[model samples]
Structure formats: structure tokens, C-alpha cells
Target chain A: MRVLIQLRPAPDVVAAVIEPGVRATAADVAGRLPGVVLDQAFAPVAVPRPVPASAYGDPLSLNQRVEFSYAPQDAAVLVRGEIADDELSTRSVLLPSARRDVAGVFADPVIHSTPTCGGDGPVGHWQDVARLLGAPEMTVEGHDGSGVTLAIVDSGINAAHVQAHLGREVIIDTERSWSPPGVGGTPGEYPVAHGTMCAFDALIAAPRATLLDIPVLLSPHNVAGLLSDAVAAYAHLRTVLEAMPAGSRSLVISNSWGLFSPGQDFPPGHPGNYSDNLAHPFNLIVASLDQAGADIVFSAGNCGRECPDRRCGFPDRPITGANSHPRVLSVGGVDTGLERVGYSSQGPGRLSDRKPDICAYTHFAGSEANGPGTPDTGTSAACPVAAGAVAAIRTRHPATEISPAQLRTLLHRTAEDRSTLGFDHDYGYGVINPPAVLESLGRHTRHAA
Target chain B: MVLLTVRLPPGATLADALARLELAEEDVDTAFGLVPIDPGTGLYAVRVAEEASHRAANTAGGPFSDPPIAPHGSQDPHDRHAPPSG
Candidate 1:
């Protein structure tokens, strides 16, 4: 019995990027030989057939039938049906080295620039933040971040940043672009300094954690993409992480990006809150990562004054913003003196839960270079600092696999609760006391050795 | 869980070496990625780095108690206005 297989048509939108190989473009069956189908093109769920992303890669040679079968159903059907000889294999579409960098959000050395808005500069506060983390006293000696790999998903890191240098080649800096060129060109555009700052914070915070700079958003260009493609890029990040050895410790994922009903172009849900719009890949991605034993840390969006409940803008309903997602270690901002940044997003997460899982000072950060105090704000710069601190804790308690919940609980337990009314939304888990956190978790071996 | 930067043969698939080394996919994913080192080198490469927890395992003693710098205080900052915007 000859079986007919239905394949996912290519995304039509990508056509603008590449030249269509004539097989599918031209008339008959004679020309369409080497064209095979990739399984991922179609999701189990229903999605309108998008304009097929242009078929990149060179054309299939005449008569060179590129055959592929969906292992999902093709295998079962082949066994059920009385079939002749059939070729079966996991299908992957031939793609152009079309891969580009996923920019990271940076702080400190990477930017050397300031927020158009406010805050203390990296140079201005570098000493202060480092001091807060117990720099000289902690052990200037490097431990190799020795074997640690912390993924920094933000604007994209500056490869030359001082923090990138501290650990040498430990930085996996990838740049993502906003509106990239047809073929892969310069990273979508130089990623804004955000991802770079995040990377710097993480590297300095953990010094020993190997840094993987995954650029999810490019700034000054391709900003919209940062929101849409984040989840997929994160999944792709998992594909990278899985390639590591087992018994890996301190598997940290840091995200310093966010949104709130950003605008019309955003998919369905608000980058900040939930919407009738598309559900962000963040929640889904975080839950999956948590299951895989990776700790995720994200920024509380900069939605301070525009409180959805008290005084939000139009359509400012409180949806589960980035900090609201469970399974993530959400962070808000504090200034150089460790005061909560007025504009930093504060929240009781998804279900009226207190958020900004913890707080980190973004306003006054120190630098590796001698620069003036250029102001900055937003949890974008704060999240990575907290992530780096987590790296330090994880580094110390190597044996204990602290679940996201436990880590949050531990932070709360060890936290020097500020307000008489502990756990308030304003400071969430209160300020980050790196020494106390380190002291609390104490020394332990991996797997209780 | 040491971070190793290994160079693959020309036209080598990083996935294959990663599989051979029995490296966890997470490490491969986090440690390595294909980047364009030189504009058109188009060569593929993989980076491998361990996590802090894993880094701790390799340590002879334990987590370093003596760090280079001292921890900063988490005291509350006094609220002040934006020094009068001109």
C-alpha cells in the first residue's frame, strides 16, 4: 500500500530572506526531488499556516530525492500497514548556517554607557556592589568558575568586557539582532548594553561560573523580536545545556528582559502581564527548565509607578508579568545605597503572590574600568547580579541541589527581613545579603557525599 | 566539571564529539555554540564549562570562605529626589 504523507509547508514569511529553490516554486513532480520535510515545522497544536519561512540552503539537484519521514507517526504506520521498502529516520530540515547570536543584557564594563534615564554608573558603584558581595575578603583567587556555566540571556554581551576577561574564554557571547539581514550578517545590530551588563554582573558575582552569553534581544534595533522569539531561543538554550556532563551543579539561567502589554505587535499576552494574546514562552520554558534542575532568575519589569492595580496605563491589567512566573527566581531593583528603585517593577506574582522574588542593587554598581557614574535603572541590570550571587551560593554548597522553591525559601530564611510586616510586595524577599546567604547554605557536597 | 575549550577538526559536527565525550547536552548547550569568530570563517565550534555546584566538586577543600573582597551591607538607602532636574 502506498501511503501519502502530509508535511508542514515552509513558513511563507521567510521567503523574503532567501531565494526559492525552483523545485517547489516550479511546476511538476520532476523538479521537487530533494525537498524533504522537517518535523518541527509543525507543532502538535494548531497554528495557521504562516507564510513559509523562505527555503534557504541551495537547491536540491535534479533527481536527488531528499526523503524524510516523521518518526512520530510514520514509524507506527509503516509497521501497521503492509508496506514495501521504506526509509525512516528522525527528520531535520537542512538550514542555512542561518544561526545568529542571542544577545545578553549587560551591566558594568560592557556598556561604559549609561541609561538614558537614571541611577549610579557601573564605575560609580562597581566598588560598592563588589564590596557588598564581599570582594577582597571572599577570596580573590579564581576557582575556574572553573567548571561553571551560567547562561546570560539578555541583549548580548560585549566580548571585550573586563568581566569576560576575568575568567578567560568562559564567556559564550552570542548576539541576537532585531531585524537581521537576509543571510546572517553582523549580530542583528550591536546589542544594546543591557545583556553585556548582565553578563558582567554574573561573571563578577560568581567569578568562577563559566558564562554563556545567549542574546535574546537586540536593542536600538529588533526590539520586538526580543519578546517574541525568547521562548524558542530558551528552548534552543536547553539543547546547548543538555550537552554538558551529568552531576552538574549550579545550573543557572539568568534573564534580564521583560514586557507589559508592551504594544500591538507583541503576540497575545503582555510581556509583563497575561493577555488574550499569545502566552509567552517564558512560563512554559521556565517550568520545563525547573523540571530539568536548572535555576532560572528573571527581572521584575520596570513597572513601578504604573501599578496596574493602583494607577496603570490603558489595558494595564495585572497579568503574570515576568517576575510573576513561578519556577523563576524573580528580582527587583535597589539603588547604590540599597534602596528599592522607585521605577523598578514590584509585584505579588501570578496569583496575587509576593514577587521580585528577591532584590539586588542596580543603581550603584562598581566597574572593572575607570569610568564616571553614568546612571541606569530597571531590573534588567539587577537580575544578573542576583543570578551571580546565586552562583556564589551554589558554588559554596556544591553538594546541595537547591530547588527553586528551596532557594527562595532559603533566601527568605536567611534574609534580614526589613519591614516589620515581612514579605511585603515592595521588597519581596528583602535586600540581598551575599554574606548571610553564603553563611546560611554553608558547606555541603554534591549528592550528599 | 572543568571548562574545556577544545577545537574540532575542520567540518566536524560538535554534536558528535559532545556525544562521544558523554557530555550532558546541557553542558554542550551552555558551554558551546557555533559562532562566527572571523567574519566568514564559518567554522563550527563547541565550548564546555561546568556549573558552580559542579565547580565545587572539583575543589580540593570546599567553597572558599576567604574571598578577594568583603560583602557589602544591605542597609536601606535614604530616599532622595532626582537632584532637581534642570
Candidate 2:
């Protein structure tokens, strides 16, 4: 059981207390409770701290220090009182209420030993989908994602296999990439099947974009492992993005995983619920990243059908957690026939007006295996495909510098509507028409010029 | 540099072909070495060194024949939400 204690002390108290070290200060505070143990304290950095406002409250002001500690589950009542003393503004219990299994979180690609005969000649399915989305035209226009950087935040990618399949070295940086403290192995070394598949799918559209492989998920762990470490992983991601040399090029992040049921109710501060509340640490972190100009993308889970799979439980609600956040571009999936894939999660997002900001092709062929024809399917496939398209536009017009909100608006306006006449739960804005998006961007560029 | 489309006999699995071909486990890197043309049906288009073509064909037995590289049109029936089946 983990607990986050928010301590608000005057600047002088902070200096005096912190000068003695965070552990000592926490020990002094924890003296009130016998069983609680001081785990870690996050102090504001002298320079602009990368920690989110929700992490310590009003990060810009640097008035509070946050400490994460653990105590016996039975001692919750005793610990809660000591941490909520008059000096403390608020206290949050970061206990894991339920275990979120990683079973269906990372969608596995279907491996076909031989290509199925028929339909559109020998071209791969991704190429056909690309042509449908006007990617060929974008490629013709020299927007093959040359100047963009796509950070894949999932399980670690198999860099060698991805490079071999794509036949190029597109992973420019893995130096800033990381796994949790005890999760060993270099980011690129872990042969995480899901991350590699996502990399392949994203590269299908933005073949030339440099990949920043940040593998948040590790082996021998479940969804709870990722959820517990996500805050730190996200903080590390911000650092990685901040370290990039100043440039006009675009930065896009593709997250192919998310929590669904959360196993708890809203407004109760469940660890799994990355609710829209600005005070929610996870939301604040994502919002901070958005303000810093990284276009984040999340896969709407494969819960569209009756939810046979554990990951896609058919809840009464439309969507859940971070995928439903307003700032991120949540993506759903469609088959080649332009119908919603039975498993793509639908939405009237908890935060956004309508979710799945857009849809793209699943059943995609990409670099999951040794070759390019591996059948990588699911909304996991769709999120990166859409991200690659965004990267392609960013590659072409580096100076355009669109905000996250503006980019969402452009995609929503330009998408080819499907399902119902306008926005619906299943299709969101509709299938991405890359050619239309490029044309709109072209017009915007010319107008700006 | 030759690409061979090896179709498995009815009831034959990819593991069977790999064994018959005598390719070491290390030699077949699933990420880039063995290309799956149709994963649903056990048909693979493998790019082998020129000298290994005959051995691959002979290993494939009666089902060994060249087929045109077809466009992938079959919908994979596997659910992405389910735990991967071996």
C-alpha cells in the first residue's frame, strides 16, 4: 500500500527541514504514526521542476513537497490522520485497489506464414491503407516524416528487428529511454513483441521519422505494474522531450496501452482512474506535456464488442481513464472495409465531448515479424498509423508548429465521416483521410506564408 | 538472394518445416528472417541464400512449389484482446 503525503510548509520551513534531508524530514513527520515508513520524497528543483502540479500542488510556485511512502494496509486510518495534519493541505492514498492484468493491453499481431492471395495485387495491406489515406501523395510531396520524432511509450521495442524490416536505421535515440528501477535490461535489448509491432505500424506511415523507444512496460509484471510506475515513467518522458535540442520539428508520442475498468468508482481518487480532474497527478502531467508541444496519442482499448476479453470489459460507460482525456488524440480502429473493428473501444469520453478523436485502419501489415507482411491488427495498430500520418505532415511543414488542440481540430475537421452522418461513439470524427489532411495543411501553410 | 514460397502440406506446421529444413533455431529470426505470407495458412515466403533454395524445396517435400506473391487479403480471425496463443 502506497500513500502520497502532500506537505505544505513555508519557504523557511522547507529550507530548514529539507536542509536536514527529505528522509529525516519525513521521519520527523512519520513519528506521529508508529507503523508508517518513509519511502521517497520529491523536492522541487531549483530550475523549473519537471514534476507535475498535481504531484506536489502548484508546481510553478514550489510551495509544497510530496512524499510517497508505504504502511500496512490495516493501518490506513492511523496513517491518514498523521499525514493530514494542519500543515498538510491534502493527502492521497496511492494504494492499488485491484490488479490490472496486462493480458490484453498489448495487442499481438497475427502472423501469417504465407500471404493470402487476391485483392489489390501484391501490395501489402498497409500500403493499400496508406494509398487510401493519401500517404502516397504525401510521400510524393516529400513528407515521409524526415524531420519528426515519434516516441513509442509501451513495452520496449526490438530495435534490430525493426531496423532490419524497415531496412533503415530510424531509431535515432534510446539514450533517454527507461524502464522502472528494478526492471533491468537496456530499452532496445528487451524483445517486447508489442512494442516492436507498434513501432512497425507507426513506421508504415512515417518511414523516415526517428523513433524514441521508451519502454514503460516490462516483463514479469501486469497492468498494475505499469499503473504504479506510469507517473515516474511519464516524468522521465518529459525529461527526454525537454532534453531534445531546440528545433522547429514536431514531436509525437504513441501510447498503445491504457487501463480500462480501474476496478473502482470515479471522484474517489482511484489510482487507475486518470480522471479529468486537473488536480489528478496523471492528468496534470499529461497536460504539462501537451503544453510543452508533444502531441500524445493513445489507443482506445479493444472493448468494442460484448467485451469477451478481460482488457475489454463491456462497462455501462463509454470510455475510461487517460484514453478518455480531452488533450490526447484517442484513436479507434477500423477494418479495411472501413467498418469499426468489433473490438475498438467506443466513446463519449469522460472528459472530451466525443472520443476517439479519429479512426484508422487495423489489420495492418508492418514490421512485427522478420518481414513487412505480418498482420498487426487492433486499435493498437490504429493509434500509431494515425500518429505516423501526423508525423508525415510535421515532417513536411516543420515550421507550421500546430498546437495539440489545433491539430485535433484539423484532424476532426478533415476526417472522412463514417457510421452515422456526423460524430458518433464508434467512429469518432471518422477515418483519417491523409490526403485531405495534407491538403488542409498545405492551405494553412500557404495562408501563413 | 532467392525468395522461396514454401507451402506446408495439409496438417503440417511451421515447426515441422523448420525441422525438416534443418535450420537451427538461431538461424530463423522471426523478426526478419522468416516472412509470413499468410499466417492463417502455414505458407511462408522465405528469402534464403541461393545455395539453400534446393535444400528448402527438398525439405518442403510435395508441397514445395513457387507461388506468386499474393496481396494479403485474408482477415486475421485472432482477437487482439486475447492473450497470445502459441
Candidate 3:
């Protein structure tokens, strides 16, 4: 066990350790101590003695008033060394009594940088994310989500709250926005919550895109909605897509909600299963929507191996159902520093092996939906951020011009590959590179022109 | 309630779906109606009670799982907006 030994060798030696120019080694101070293997490289440090400030104050307890004194006679020196693990307790108790000069022996525990967990503070602000995504350059280049329709299929959106945080007017297509069967609330007027945060993140790159508030998540059960509701919601969105002209259709659906447990689902191989079965009604609808030229993006859940969310119940391959569907872009989370957030789920997804198709900025200080100073966190936030990037590209290149399959290939090809070989489960094809995508689109546009 | 899918011609209604599946109105969630999964493929979905779903599954597509879903975020378990129990 590594430990710090406190010794009151002599006043002159204590003064020498405290002196700026003078150097005092462990051997120079203590001479020799038995059993402890002294660390010769570690310089001895002088520790201040605490003196009681009041007559009633106890010197041993710091709960009362006390003053730290650096007087040579009062001060003690601390030296680093290791002792046998078996004899640690014995030596710690006997060291001071064994040597008259030995004051105390204290533990020197190892420490490390704490990885950002679920409840931790934001890593950086949203503007830093805008910079990381090269949002300004994309906006300046005319890929600013004009005339595009971006749908947020989550709880419900509060346009006022989203507008306040974004510092801009939010365009809600009241005519197109739809709610589930029994869900009550007007389009863009629901309470501020998860859906609003998704709206705010998506508009970062595609501010001009019209938002379709599809609150499939709000149901009669209060905070919960059945998968059947999502199926019905997708059906409404299909009509919305069909209403648009085929040659100019541009609808980007951002889904930040998913199933967290297999308990509710039919077992994997069951005929009615939704997790790994593409034949399931919801999965089929997702495929139908993708086939109809809607750019769908889903969050790769918060069930990461290192520090998973408490609600994650999937024992393995947490990315399941439509969130793992091959047709959609499954987004994982990364902080503004470009490091994958510890809670961003890794892949080898059930529906598609190369899931988490790309990563995007998250865990940043944005939308005060959760509260002031809280980050827009989880792969939930990252999904819309990547969806926003796709919307930005769609501003100039409609789905008719660049098919969803073709666009997905471009994103994978141009991604900033994080691993030595091409792809890995952790980062998939790597972080979404908006600038590279824009550049590629520009090249295609010039060639077509 | 469980979900069941059926194929119908374009512009099919809940009445048309019920008549084709041979299910009565009481066993179906009328509010949910008949949702089109693929308009081009003439595919539609309906919500029915477990027993009705089993009977309809013979002709319709499923007695499929209707699992609950919630937003994926780092929220306090006791918070009002926490993800729903499975």
C-alpha cells in the first residue's frame, strides 16, 4: 500500500523542507525507517500544524475554529513510501510509536479523471457545438434547410420555449403537424420538454426548415405511449410526404424515443417480435417511410456499457427495433470535445450490424428544457443534431436529387473515421462531417449543372 | 390492445377493415381507426383486444407486440418525464 508518512524529525530539518531554495530528501530527514520501502524520487513536503483558536476549541477536531501554523517546531514533514499490503494496518498503527520522531502514517490513494456520467454538468456550450459541426459555413453556402420539412416524433413540442432558446422565429406547419388518437394539445403548443429540446438541436444547422410536430409519445398513460401509436403517427407522416411533389420532396424525421427493454417485446425469434424482426408492423412502416423519400434518424439509446442510464433494461445489444433499422441513420452521442460520451450505446445492432451510422455533438449547454445549466444530453439530443445536418444538405439537394440511400452512403463515406481499420462498433463510420458532406454535394451540383 | 395489419385497396376505412377481418366494433379501438402502414402496398394496421387479435390474426397480419416507448435521455428516475416502465 502506498502511504504518506508524517514525521517531526527536527526543527532545523522541518525548516529546511519548508525553505524555498533548500532541498530535503526522505533519507536526510528520517535517516531510516524499518519495513517501509521509501520512495526516493518523492520530495518531502512540510505540513502545517493546526492550533486551537479558542480555549474551548479542540485541536484534534476541525469542526471548531483553528488556525494553521507553519512554525518550525510545530510543523511536520510528509514523505511518500510503500509498505506491504499484509502489514499495512499494523505498520500504520505502530510506525509513530516505533520511532519517536514519527508523527503519523496516512494513505495516498490513486486518482483519475472522472468520465462524464448521466447527472454531470454540461461539458461545453451549444455554440461550441455549432463551431464543431461547421454550421456557419454550411448556412453561408445555401444549405440552410429552406423549404425542407423536419419532423420531431417524440413527446410533444413547445414552440415558444424552443423559439426563446434558439433566439429566432420557429416555423411550425400547423396544417401538417399531427398528434396520436387520444393525445390532446395543439401543434407546437405542448409543454416544454424532450420534444422541444430535439427541435432546438435540429434547427442548429437547418433553422429555416419547417417543423412538423408529431407528438406520438404523449398518450392517455401520461408519460408513456405504445408502439402502436408510433405506427399510427408514421402513417400520418406518410400522407404528409405523399402530399408533397415527388421531384421536390424533403422531409427529415427525427426520432429520439425508443424501447429500452425486451420484457415488453415478444422474444427475439418470435413471429410477432419488434426487436430483431423486420416483419413487425412498426418496422415495416419505418421501411415504408424511408422508401417514400423521408430521411429518418433515430437515437442509438443511452445504454452504453461504461455508464448506462438507470432505465436501460436490455441485457445486450441495447440498440433494438427501428432505432437499429438499416434504413435509418442511428446516431450516437459525443460531447463538444468530439469524445464519445460514456453513456452513448455501442453497436453491432440487432436489426443492422453497423448501427450508430454516425455520431454527433451532445452533452452540451443548450435548451434549458431540463433546467438552467443542464446539458441537452444523451443520444436523444445527438439524433436531432445529425438529423439537422441532413436537413441542411436537403435545403439545396432534395431527396429526389439525392436519394436517402445515396445520401446515407455519402455520410458514411465522408465521416471522420475514428479507428485504424475502416469501421468499429464504438463510433461506427465515425463522427458526422457536415463540411465534407457539403463539399461533396457541391461537387455533385456542379457536375449536374 | 394488440396490433393487426391487413391489406386493402387505396381509400379503405375502419369499417372496410372490420368487415374484411370479421371483427366486431366492440373488440377494436375505434379511436385509433385503421392506419395505413404502406399506402402503395395497400397495407393497413388496426388495434384490437387480445382475443379479437388472435381471431383476426388468421386473416390479418399480426397479434403483434404493442410495446410502450419513451424519450431517451438522462432523467431522474423519480422525475415526472422519466421513460415509461416496459
TM-score of 2: 0.58
Model 3: per-residue Cα lDDT over B1-86, one tens digit each:
88899999999999999999999999999989999998889999999998998788678997789998988873463322232110
* Fnat across every predicted model, in order: 0.00, 0.03, 0.54
Taking the tens digit of each residue's C-alpha lDDT, what string does model 2 give over A1-449? 34343333234433444343542344343333233344435332111123433654764454556433222211111112223243232222222112121001111233323211111111247667777767767777888888688888767688788787767675656676666656677766666367777787788778888887766666234432333345446656766656655567478888777654433223324321244343344555577777677788887766665322344333544455567788889898776777676657778776665897899877556554423344666577788888888888778555236776788888889998985478888889998887787788789779999
- Whole-model lDDT, candidate 2? 0.58
Question: Which 10-residue window of candidate 1 chain A scores lowest in summed lDDT?
Answer: A74-83
Candidate 3, A287-375: lDDT as tens digits? 99999999999999888877887778889999999999999999998888777877788998999999889999888888878877778
In order, candidate lDDTs are 0.46, 0.58, 0.88
- Candidate that beats the other on TM-score, 1 or 2, i.e. the better one: 2
The TM-score ranking, best first, is 3, 2, 1
Q: Estimate the lDDT of model 3.
A: 0.88
Better of 2 and 3 by lDDT: 3
Local accuracy of candidate 1 as per-residue lDDT tens digits, B1-86: 22222234544455654554455566644423432111122322233443532332332111111001000111112222221000
- The candidate maximizing lDDT is 3
